[model samples]
Structures are given as C-alpha cells and as structure tokens.
Target: MSNLDIFVGETSGTAMLILLGGGVVAGVVLKRSKAFGAGWVAISLGWGFAVMVGAYLSAPKSAASLNPAVTLGLAIQGGIKWSDVPLYIGSEILGAMIGAFLVWVAYLGQFSAFLTDPQVLAQQPAEEGLVDQKSAPNAGPVLGVFSTGPEVRNYWQNLLTEIIATFVLVIAILTQGLNQNGDGLGPIGILITSFVVVAIGLSLGGPTGYAINPARDLGPRIVHALLPLRNKGGSDWSYAWVPVLGPLAGAALAGGFYQLAFA
Candidate 1:
C-alpha cells in the first residue's frame, strides 16, 4: 500500500475502534444511557466487536494496524519499515483522539446530566482553592468513559498488569494473527485476535482496565483532560505514563520474543 493509503486506513480504523470501544464504556458508565450498568461483560464483548469491525474495515487498505503497539510489534518483526512507523503511530493516535471526541459529542446530554448531577458532584473532592496531584490523584468519574484506571492504586502492580496483559495480546497477534507474508491479519486472524482481546479483558482487565493499546489509552485520556464537562475531575495525569509505557514495553518484549523463538 502507498503511504497515503496506510495513513488513511490506520487513522480511520483506529477512529472506528475508539468510537465503538469508547462508546460502549460511555453507555455503561454514564447515566440515562440504555446500557448503563450493563457491567463488564458487555464492555469486553463490545470492545472485541469493535476491534473486529475496525480491522475488517481497514484490512484491505492498510493492514488495519489500529494500535500503536501492534504497529511497533510489526515494525520490530520487520513486517513494516522503520521509516513508516511514525506515520502509523501518528495516525493511530490522531484517530483515537478523533474517536474520543466523537464519543463526547454522541453522549453530550448524558455527560451533562452525569457531571451536573448533584449527587455525582457531591462525591468529588472539594477544590480547596488549589489542588495538587496528591489531593486528587485518582481519575474523575467521567474519565472512565474515556480512559483506564486501576481499582487498586499501586503503580508497580498496575504497570506490571498492563505489561503482562499487553504482552499476551501482542504475542498472540505476532504468532497467530499475522498472515502468510507476515504483514497483517487475515480474516480468520482478525476474528481470533478480537476474541483474544475479549479473553484478555475478561481474565485480566480488573487491575488496570486492560489498556493494552497506548493510543487507545493516551489519546482518549488527552481528550478527557481537554473536554469542558463540568465536575470532571483530574485526568489522573500521574498515572498516564503507566498505560503508554507499559503497552509499548510489552509490545517490544513480544516482538523480541517473536524474533528469538518464532522468526
């Protein structure tokens, strides 16, 4: 594929991934939504279907690398050129941001209601004039609709969980999902990979919300920080690096492992 095709496909696919994936979270977390409190199973299934749909839509154009970690893994596996890595990662992040913005737009009323609700605001920490990270280090209520956070706030444990979960995800893709020429996933590969995502979510998502994709976490988190929703507390910037770095580290390890054991 040409450079333009790769950019367009990655951007569009990643957008679709976040749109549906984030949309599901919004539906579950936000009040007034029909799927509110639908629980974790719905989220896992929604994200899996989102991945499948995004991959299927973009497969023919640019191999459907919607995740930056996946693109990095492919690059390390020599399935993609180093020079083109920036294009793929950039597009993925941009697409993720766009998708998150769309999620906000789609749920504007719900967000307004949730954030402006007296009960929800009562649960938030008081401003106390100026607040530091320590004062409100945890994510705000609405943040979960856009990004991941830990049920337990141990950084080391969270980081390790993300790393291990992402390692499983990336290694699975490297080993089983790549097509004959090792460029991208085939149709069956895409479906199986989506199931792998669902499996990871069901088995390991509780700790750190299973943010195995840097773009999926970081881009939306950025959007969460920037949006104008009332009573939306901190974006948990202190913990942001864990998701971004952990997934990249896992993908790197997975790629290295693939080179050593499978290549």
Candidate 2:
C-alpha cells in the first residue's frame, strides 16, 4: 500500500472502530436510550462487531491496522516497515478522534439530558476545583463512554491490568490473527480477532476496561477533554498515561515473545 492508502485506510478503520465501540457504551449508559442498562454483554458484543466491520472495510487498503498497538506489534514482528509506522499510528489516532466526535454527535440528546439531569448534577462536586481533586480522577460519569479507566484508584495495579490484557490481545494477533501474506487479517483471522476482543472484555475488562490499544483510549480521551459537555467533570488526565504506556509495553513484549517462541 502507498502512503495515501495507509493514511486513508487506518484513519477510516480506526474511526469506525471507535464509533461503534464507543457508541455501544453510550447507548447502554446514556439516559433515554432504548438500549440503556443493557449491561456488559451488549458492550462486549458491540465491540466485537465493531472490530469485524472496521477490519473488513480497511483490510483491502492498508491491512486494517486500526490500533496503534497492533501497528507497533506488526512493525516489531517485521510485517510492516519501520518507515510506515508513524503514518499508521497517526492515522489511527486521527480516526479515533473522528469516531469519538461522531459518537458525541450521534448521542447528543442523550448526553445533554444525562449531564443536565438534576439528580446527576447533584452527585457532582460542589466546587469546580474539586472536579479533579475530590471528585473522580479516574473517570467522569460519562468518560467511560469515551475512554478506559480503572474501577480501583491504584495506578500500578491499573497499569499492570492494562499491560496484561493488552499482551493477551497483541500476542493473539501476532500468533494467529494475521493472513498468509502477513500484511493484514484474513476473514477467519478477523473473526478470531473479534472474538478474542470479546473474550478479553468478558474476562479481563473489569479492572481497567481492557484498553489494549493506545489510540483507542488516548484519542477518544482527548476528544472528551475538548468537547463542550456540561458537568462532564475531569478527563481523568492523571490516569491517561497508564493506558498509553501499558499497551505499548505489552505490544513490545508480545512482539519479542513472537520472535522468540513462534517465529
């Protein structure tokens, strides 16, 4: 693929990934939505379908690397050129931001109602200064719709959880999810990868929401911070680095393991 193909494919695919993935969380959590309170099963299945759709759409153009962690792992495994890494990652981030913005647009009324609800506002910290300090620093009320956060406040534990979950994801991709040419996912591989995501969410998502992709978490978090939503609370900037670094570290580990054990 040329640089343009890589840019367009990764951007569009990652956008689709976040659009449907985040949309599910919004639908389940946001007030007045038909799917409200649908629970975790819906979220897991939604994300799986999101991955399948995004990968299938972008596979022909840029091998459908919708996550920065996936791109990094593939680069380390020598399936992608080093020179193209930046384009892949940058496009994924851009796409994720676009997807997040679209989610906000799609759920505008729900977001407005949820944030402006008197009871919901009553739970917020009285002082704006306490938004990040005394209030939830790990996540805002609706922030989970945009990014991952830990249920517990321990930084090390959260980081470790992200690393372990991401390791499982990237290792599975490196070992069994790639196509024969080693540049993209085959149909079977895409199905396997989507199910792997669902399994990870089902088993490992409780602690930290399983942010196995840096762009998936960081890009949306940026959008959440910038969006003009009332009573949105803090963006949980303090916990942001954990998801970013942990996933990259996990991808590095997976790439090295693949080189040592499976290559």
Candidate 3:
C-alpha cells in the first residue's frame, strides 16, 4: 500500500482500538457506568475484541499495526521498512489520542461524576482550600482509564514485565505469517494476533497490566494529562518510560532473536 494508505489505516485502526479498549476500562471503573466493577475478565476480553476489531478494519491497508511496539518489531524483523516506521507510530499515537477523547465524550456524564463524586470530595481536608479534584495529587481515579499502572512498584520489575510480555507479543507477530504485499498481517493472521493479545493479557497482565504496545499506553496517557476531566489523577509520568522503553527493547530483542533463530 501507499504511504498515505498506511497512515490512514494505522490511524483509523488505532483510534478504534483505543476507543473500545479504553471504553471498557471507563465502563468498569467509572461510578455511574453499567459495567462498573465488571472486573479483569471483562477488561482482558474487551481489549482482545478491541484488537480484533481494529486489526480487521485496518488489515486491508497498513496491516493494522496499532501499537508502536509492533511497528518497531516489524521494522526490525524486516516486515516493515524502517523509513515508514515513523509514519506508522505517529499515526498510531494520534489515533489513540483521538480514541481517548471520543471515550471522554461517550462517557461525559460519568466523567462529570468522577470529578464531583461524594467519595472523592469527602476526602478533601476542608482547610486545604477547594481541592482541585480535577488536578488532585494523583488526579483522583481516572488515571487507570487512560494508562497502565503496576500492582507492584518496582521499576526494574515493571520494566522487565513489559519487556517479557512485549517480547512474546512481537515474536508472535513476527512468526504469524508473511504478508504477500509486505505491508501488514494477512486477514487470518490478524485474527490470530488478536488472540495472542488476549492470551498475553490473561497470563501476564496482573503484574504491570501488560503494556505490550507503547502507543497504546503513552498516547492515552498524554490525553489523560491534557484532558479537562474532573479529578483525573496524575498520568504517572515517572513510570511512563518503563512501558515505552521496555516495549521498544522487547521489540528489538524479539526481532533480533527471530533473525537469529528462525530467519
């Protein structure tokens, strides 16, 4: 496909992917949503289906590399050209940001409640002056809806977790199938790739939320930091580099390993 086609496909696919993936998190976490507390199973399945939908939609164009890690891995593995990596990653990030904004619009009422919720307000020390719940120390409870966090706070461990998970993911993608046109995954390959995401989530998601994709986490996190949401917590910028760097490292390792072991 042409460069323009690649950009459009990745953008649209990633936007939809984040929209559905982040939507599920919002539904489960936000107070007023019907899916509130629906739990981890719902999240994993939702994200899997999100991948399925996004990959299917973009399969005809840029092969639906909705994650920057995937793009990096593909480039390293020679499945994608290095020259095109920037385009794909840029499109994916933009799409994720747009998707996150759409989620805010879709859950506008819930987000309003997130800011003004009695539970959050009750915690404010009356002497502190009207607590800017919107910009509260941790930004309240909306951070998870936008990005990944660790159950454990070990930076090295968290980085390793992401690297391992993304290694598995990138390896799976590299070995999945050869795209005849050399642009993206085949249709069946896309379906398999979605399942691989689900498997990774089910097995390894507990530690650090399995941020196997850089764009998926960073893009939404950036939106989280910028959006006008009420009581949205800190975007956890301190830990953000783990997800981004770990995945890139993992992709590089996977690509190198593939070239050595299988190529």
Candidate 4:
C-alpha cells in the first residue's frame, strides 16, 4: 500500500500540469489557425483538443476528466439536444474510457518495467508531483479554483466544484463569446473554458480528484476496476456518485444562472 501510495501520489500532479499545459497550447495554437472557427467553436475545439492532447500524452491511462460540469451543463443547456445527449454522453464516456485505457497501458508498461526495480520506486521523491506544482492561471473568477483540484472526495465537494466550475465555464463562454472583444475570436469561449478548468484543477482538485468530467472520472474509474492488470484492486464505487452528480447539479445551477443573467 505504501508503494502504491508513493507511486500514485508521485504521478498525480502530472495530470493537472499536462491538462493546463495542453490548454495553453490550445489557446496559442487554435487562435492562430483556421482549422476551427475563431470564437466559441475555437474554444470548444480548443478544449476538445486540450482533452485530446492530455489524453494522448497521458496515453495508456485515462487523462484527467477534462470538464465534468461543462458536459452536464451542455446537456442541460440543450446544446446536446435531448435526442442526442444520451448518445453524446455515451460517446463521451467511451472516449474517456479509451483515453484512460491507453494511458494506463502506458503506465502499466512503466510499472512492469519497474516491478522488480525497488530502487526506482523508492527513489521517487515527494513534493515533485503535479498536485503541488504551479500551473497556468485561469482568469475567470470562479474558474481559478478548478486548477487547484477538488477539496475533498465527498459528494458535496465534488458537486460544489462542479457547480462553480460549470457556472464559470458557462459564464466564461458567455462573457467572452458574446462580447466584442471575444466574439471576434471563436475559440475565446473554449479558451475561457480551458482556463476555467485550469483554475478549478489548481484550486479545487484535492479530493475526489476534481473529476471535472463525468466520463473522464467514471469511465476510466470503471476501466481501472475492469482491466486485467497486475495488482489492480477494488475501485472506489462509493465515491463514484460525486463526479457524476456534482457536475449535473452544477450544470442545473448554471442553467438557472444563465437564464437569469441572459434571458
């Protein structure tokens, strides 16, 4: 258990750093290219790419859940139509599972390579992981917390993080895309989301691991329990509800807020 603790703890911080690093690239790269629209599409695609790159680099293991509350918020906003949301959500889960599978496979490779190398595992020092590392800042007020990771593993903590993350994400998208300053650039909205994610991860992702994306959390979590790998053990089914419920709850709140603010 101590070995696993050191092992997992060592790499935990890597997740958020890569997440934000990818976001920075997304912001810088997407804006300059025409592959995606300039404003909201840019940002959505920016986030999507951020998710993809984070997933890619973190391959053989599930990358962090990119944006949990936003997925629920989009579902709530009807952005993912009623008829399509189920499929969207399912696809999201599948995508997340696949990403995790790859990342874990990669992780397992390193694990396999080191299974006999006690020295390697033992030498991995503390205070060297992403959990404590400094990352890019999210400008949005509510979003800055996302970059910090979640507070606790509790359902409510996850839920509140989701609420705030979603609220900020939506607000960022709205505030930027709808404005003269941001609307001109399509990805601005998504850039806004990316930073919001960074914010939440940096400030709020302590417990429950700031599962900002339901698919990112549950999908890979399910994978962790299912994959036939060495020393794989029980998955935390008890806390599964946090990532799932928190985002949805937050999205609902965002909807109310969105309605009142813009409607």
Task: Please provide TM-scores, in order, for all candidate models, with all chains considered together.
Answer: 0.93, 0.94, 0.92, 0.58
lDDT of 2 by residue, 27-137 (tens): 988878899888888898899899999998888889787988888889988888989999999999999999999999999999999888888666643211122334354
Q: Judging by TM-score, tell me the better candidate of 2 and 3.
A: 2
Whole-model Cα lDDT of every candidate shown, in order: 0.86, 0.86, 0.83, 0.43
Prediction 1 TM-score vs. true? 0.93
Q: Show where candidate 1 strays beyond 4 Å.
A: 124-138, 180-182
The digit string of per-residue lDDT tens for model 4 on 154-173 reads 45655676656556655554
Order of candidate numbers by lDDT, starting with the best: 1, 2, 3, 4
| Segments in model 4 whose C-alpha atoms lie over 4 Å from true places | 1-49, 52-68, 113-154, 177-185
* C-alpha-based local distance difference test score of model 4: 0.43
- Greater lDDT among 1 and 3 belongs to 1
Q: Write the number of the candidate with greater TM-score, choosing between 3 and 4.
A: 3
lDDT of 3 by residue, 63-145 (tens): 68899999988888787888999999999999999999899999999889866887755663211112233323554467777
Candidate 2 steric clashes = 0
Instruction: Identify the superior model by TM-score, candidate 2 or candidate 4.
Output: 2
By TM-score, rank the candidates, best first.
2, 1, 3, 4
lDDT head-to-head 3 vs 4, winner: 3
For every candidate structure, what is the RMSD over all alpha carbons to the true structure, in angstroms?
3.9, 3.4, 4.6, 13.9
